[model samples]
Target: MTDPTYEFSRAITRRPAASITDGLRAEDIGTPDLGRMLASHAHYVETLKKTGAEVIELAPLESYPDAVFVEDTTLCLPQGAVMMRPGAPSRMGEVAEMEPTIRGVYDEVRQIAGPGHIEGGDILVTGREILVGRSDRTDAAGVTELTEIVSDWGHTVREVFTPPGVLHFKTDCSLLDGETILSTKRLDASGCFEGYRVLHVAEGEEAAANSIRFNQFVLAPAGFPRTTEMLRQNGYDVVEIDNVECAKLDGGMSCLSLRF
Candidate 1:
């Protein structure tokens, strides 16, 4: 079999803070149960380990309510890693906390300096191209800076407009493989993924779009059966885990871990 384009050997994640129930959420969803969120996070870390990745679980930052979603702080790539400046002022400190961890693993690491805000969730690395989404958490300036940084690594950066209702680009879509994407119908219609093949999430299962394809299996949230079936029918080995509490905080499978 051919090697997968986005396989990873290491990953980073953070424990959910006791303040996790205060995380930023678009809707008025009830607070997530901290105990349940922690359990789910532990399960996520375990799953990452099962993928043969050396999972680094960072201590939770009670001050940063949204820090559990570590994927928003930096983008880890084979070339190196990029520490981001989150557009949300409350999330800015997460970058500083994530830098040392990233530096430990990458010989060459870069930072998206201020006046330019970007979030890892808005960046997707697929083969030779890096697709960045222009969202509330990521602006054009951020994308421009990111493009310049990754260009040195021989990557072509393309900016895509994230839909209005989405919190981040990856919230509506994810890279399933080098040439295929798992996306919500709304995002697929946004014309951002013109050249790639898209597998639309089942109707009413939009959250399922935010999934990750680890080394050998696809990590998807439980309770989205239709979407799960779609993945199975496409020949992927799927591992479903309960993410009820995380979902309440606008977090998903991909948001919990940063793989490289």
Candidate 2:
């Protein structure tokens, strides 16, 4: 009865490269400082290691500015790993770059061979089912392909909707445990998490919804005090890491790594 959703034995992360300043973003908030991003990434990896999980840190790919966001490349499940087809043309190469590492860890590695596109960020695996959000990055054809692939492995895929202007489905919510979820008010209002126990981040701290529950700790982005206190009061061991630099590139706690 182990929950692969939160309890993971291994994780994969990539160090931020000097070219992270060129990473894609919805807006040009500012360029990410490589030094700061490196320090924060180290803290993130260290936190994962403290959970007793082997953290495989990959070398940076200078040619791909968004390569540090390894989560967008693949979806790791207990049954197998699925390589994603990123809709962002610049990010498509990241899947190939990640295949070798994924194959090294999982014997069964499937891929979304598609004229349609899907990014791992748009998919969420829960205890009951797999929720695939239809975003700019993930389309019907992509979701259909994913459903066909995972159905063979005894998993159900449910198509959902990502709010307008959101970068990814997970940008507004995260699974806290087997049945509980930490989400934003706006997303919860959509009844996307109807059957699960939902906890909303305090108003105006929507970014906090991107936190991840790994083993015994919830790695969350720093600067969201109300959300942090809320999670702690709800009995989660929250580890706040500096996310300023990552956020500049539209990255968050869950975006920085792929856990399994």
What TM-score, over all chains together, does every model reach?
0.97, 0.99
Q: Alpha-carbon error at 108 in model 1, in Å?
A: 0.4
Q: Find the number of clashing residue pairs for candidate 1.
A: 0
lDDT digits (tens) for residues 1-260 of candidate 2: 67889999999999988989899999898988999999999999999999999999999999999999999999999989999999999999999999999999999999999988999888888989999889888999999999999999999999999999999999999989989989989888988898999999999999999999999999999999999999999999999999999888778999999999
lDDT of model 1, residue 124: 79
Candidate 1: minimum summed lDDT over ten consecutive residues — where?
A: 1-10
lDDT of each residue in 40-88, candidate 1, tens digit only: 8888888889877898989999999999999999988777888999998
Candidate 1 segments exceeding 4 Å error? 1-5
Least well predicted 10-residue stretch by lDDT in candidate 2:
115-124
Candidate 2: TM-score?
0.99
* Candidate 1 structure lDDT: 0.88
- Clashes (backbone N, CA, C under 3 Å), per candidate, total 0, 0
